[model samples]
Target: MLTPQWLDALRARITLSAVVGRSVRLQKAGREFRACCPFHDEKSPSFYINDAKGFYHCFGCQAHGDAIRWLTDHQGLAFMDAVKELAAEAGMELPAPDPRAAKSAERRASLSDVTEAAQRWFEDNLSAPIGTNAREYLAKRGISDASARAFGFGFAPDQRQTLKAALPFDEALLAEAGMRIAPEDGGEPYDRFRGRLMLPIHDARGRVIAFGGRTLAKDAGGAKYLNSPDTPLFDKGRTLYNLHRAAPAARKAGRIVVVEGYMDVIALAQAGLAEAVAPMGTALTEHQLELLWRQADCPILCFDGDAAGQRAAMKAIERALPILKPGLSLGIVRLPAGLDPDDLVRERGAAALEALLSRPQPLAEALWEFERDAGPISTPEAKAGLKARLLDHVGTIGHPDIRALYRRELLERFSALAFPPRYARVFGREARRGEQARTSAPAVIDRLQQLAKGGARDGFGLAVLSGLARHPGEISRHEEALIHLARAEPALGPAIDALLALSETLDSPAPSPISGAIGLPALPDRNLYAFLIEGNSPDLVREDLAEAVSLLVEKPALKAAKAAATARFDRDPEGSMAEQGRLRAREMALDERIKRLGRKRAASPRDDSSRSPSPGAMTAQATD
Candidate 1:
């Protein structure tokens, strides 16, 4: 655990001014500095940085936090990890981890060691006989040896345990890194990537977290390309290959060229078009999209002109619509027919690929492809169906003005299609329906508020009710939202109770049970709850014994009840059947309640009391 003095020192070291100045142009506003918020799309500056307070607050998005919090949220670092990063930036050494944190740190270190070992083994093999074919194949593909080493290309030997002999890492650790197989018969570990070309996957911070391997042989058994499974350090869905090296170049070019494979990214970079990344075989996920969005203003998705590639590009566009805004754009760079990015760069030279990237189609042009490819709308029914699909796509756009313009464009396009005048009415009707849907959402919010104030039987339920009542329209019925809230406020049992009541009252079924809802409290109530439960609880509660005690004991004051039961059981030794039964019931009830409370405490998070009121809070107070 970080001491208060250490936290204060760390806060003083990396102020909000430093963070904002690096990303945004700031103007002095009395004691605070103001700039356009980096967290969202904004024209006028609404982000305020208070250097004296070591925090930042954006009036536009209601994003307010200290330096560490800002780094964690904006840069996507884990809380303690963010703290350490900031501390390192500030030239401060981190204190030794406590027992619990020590174990976690050790596990992370083990994973890191495994990855580093695998990376070194691959690097060594790249020059050896085992990697000769892979190296020659790269040369044939026009990848220079210098470029190959720069991007850390290597080859995994066909033989098993090739890496095991080279590194001091244990088999279990290698298996965790997605490098070796865990044996059932206590046999020696075997390589996971046999007879494949290796491309080391690095995090945004440039640490080798995992690897992506491609089959050398056309008839290779398993997958054509294999990516590392989710481990302690790498999540394939959240990672973009070559992002670490490409980020600076992408930012400089004001665009990121997203390709489909490891070779596409490497070949582009080698060809001197450095701003390129590839999805790890999966469709462009929202997580990957957000990562790219953070690096540059616009991201150009360059895929092959083949049917599969077009389908992938469209999927990417659909995934990005909600996230992409005015300054942030998504354009498509269509390669020549039947040619992938790697093939184009290899044959036509890097200049041709770079020219295509430089002259990407506008977002509207790419979005229009969705309609163009769907076939013509000659009849009224066809036009109506088209308009509905277009409207759904427009609705997904986050910007209202952008959505409205697209709606108008859809109407204009339909008019051009020579559809009857009645077809234009379909666009108007769909726009009205979208408006109505937004208006109807408040009704759900109002219902949740009513449930919260109704004082449900469960105290935990009432607490949850109170929270939902506080943010009526903002909350969602999705399990993710609940889980997010639970993580923000560990002591959200009461709030969750209210949510449960709201769910029940609305005749909606509760979804799957999420145990860690209270893990990292996001709300003020949740944060308070976590502080109380984790920081203030006795050793029993801290040890997760509270749940067992709650189930065994009865009533609200579980500690007192447990004490009474224990005394009765001790005095009688061979107690009466009725007395023993009563004692057992009390004990069980207490255990259940403790568990419930523990879960609740984990869900609700408290706001940092050390910081002053944010701009929004001050304005709210003034209004009140």
Candidate 2:
């Protein structure tokens, strides 16, 4: 009862060569491994293992299968046993046995039988005299006879009970397979499709699971394109049409193309672009996107250029952001206006589509452009809205590194857009500011030294300063926050200012004498928090530091909000009290977070100066 996705994951983890090489010695044959066929009697090697495709094949005996198949066929294990062995090897936990799910699987198998029978019957009808109109419709769409046959094109006759009468399956099974629809008032079932050119939708194993039909009659008073309802055998959201065929072609072509419909997939295939697939008449789903990623790192989405298509691409972008990994993403190709893959190939030829596919707009660029041009941005409010929209999209991204990068990049773009730079003037002004900050750093450091020597420091404030000193690179990253911190606690102003000025002057991230100059002890003394302790993970420390700074920034903002609510209490007592309550809850949460961060302090510094300088001493030591 294991799901296809789970089985696919197990196979993806287990290498075919590694499994086959256990039984037969395999030699490196370019990108694949080759060895003598274990399935047949042969002297020369004909068996080949392609780890890239996750399958092995033999030319001698024509025996072919994947890792699970290899275990079953060659190793003499049962199907479930083979899956269990591979799952154990792959460190995957087998799904607990569910009787209901088993029943569902059995039901789907029977429904698949119904769909398969219906497919054959439809194909026969297409070849018969009744299928002449469907054949002519294919011709007009530039679909060849061979391409139609390869795609298993068929037709449902313009009759109500044709499919039910032709197939030997029971009426209930036919209705369950979506080949027939049962009457609501409990009468006999009728054919679900009538007078439509049929294209069978398949599972990943190329088993006919459902059907999509396009009307052949021009004057038919019904929807032009209709897909089968979600049956036990078909979950349209999780299924991509033609993926079974397109996956192998995608590996060879190094890319996969996604179009709008099955017809577009066929047209692309006929145009020599066999590595194309389409969703089941819906926007791309998360499962389908993962299926595409399995074949290619960044499958190009070749959607049409009309408004609906553009919205589809945007929908895909929104869907993809939360699940995107380091290398796994989608590329987008927007076809010319008023043209789809089918029309484009028919009119301009396949090379036109190829040229467009060769250089697809990156997903990021597509997102930016779609949002940027979504509406007018002439006013300040409009521009701010655009920035907010971009940030909203960036915030959905799950990976922390990718989210930060996208935030930085999108905000930088927003800055460039909102306040277009005058490069020479701005550069000169920045250079002067940097030079002034540099010249004044020593004086500021001296002031910090005097203050640090005399004061009974606040422990949290000291930790924050020491944290910045230990990680000077973080100074620039949290510059604005530090400035706000300096404002909120004027006692730490000089030290924070000195760190800010020094951040501009330091050329490298190497430890400096800031800690010593600022009247703190050497590197070992600065381990006030676990984040600053030596041997801590760099990423963890950065995260902890970011949280600490964010809390520090939030403290003053919360205080100000509470003050405003108090001030308004005289005029709007009830509303202001509610606001006050909300702010008080936030203040408590902020305090709890600060306490949690403070609890990350280590026992004490280990007197390990040989390791590196403390935050206070970014460079070599300096005397007061």
Q: Number of clashes in every candidate structure?
A: 68, 10
Stretches of model 1 off by over 4 angstroms after superposition: 1-8, 11-83, 89-102, 183-189, 376-380, 418-624
User: Candidate 1, residues 155-230: lDDT per residue as tens digits?
Assistant: 8887886677877877678788888887789876688888888889988767899998888987877998888889
Model 1 residue 572 CA deviation in Å: 52
> TM-score for all predictions?
0.56, 0.63
Best by lDDT: 2
Error of 2 at 80 (Å): 7.8
Alpha-carbon RMSD, each predicted model = 19.6, 11.9
lDDT of each: 0.66, 0.78
Residue 432 lDDT in candidate 1: 23
Residue 334 lDDT, candidate 2, scale 0-100: 85
Which TM-score value belongs to model 1? 0.56
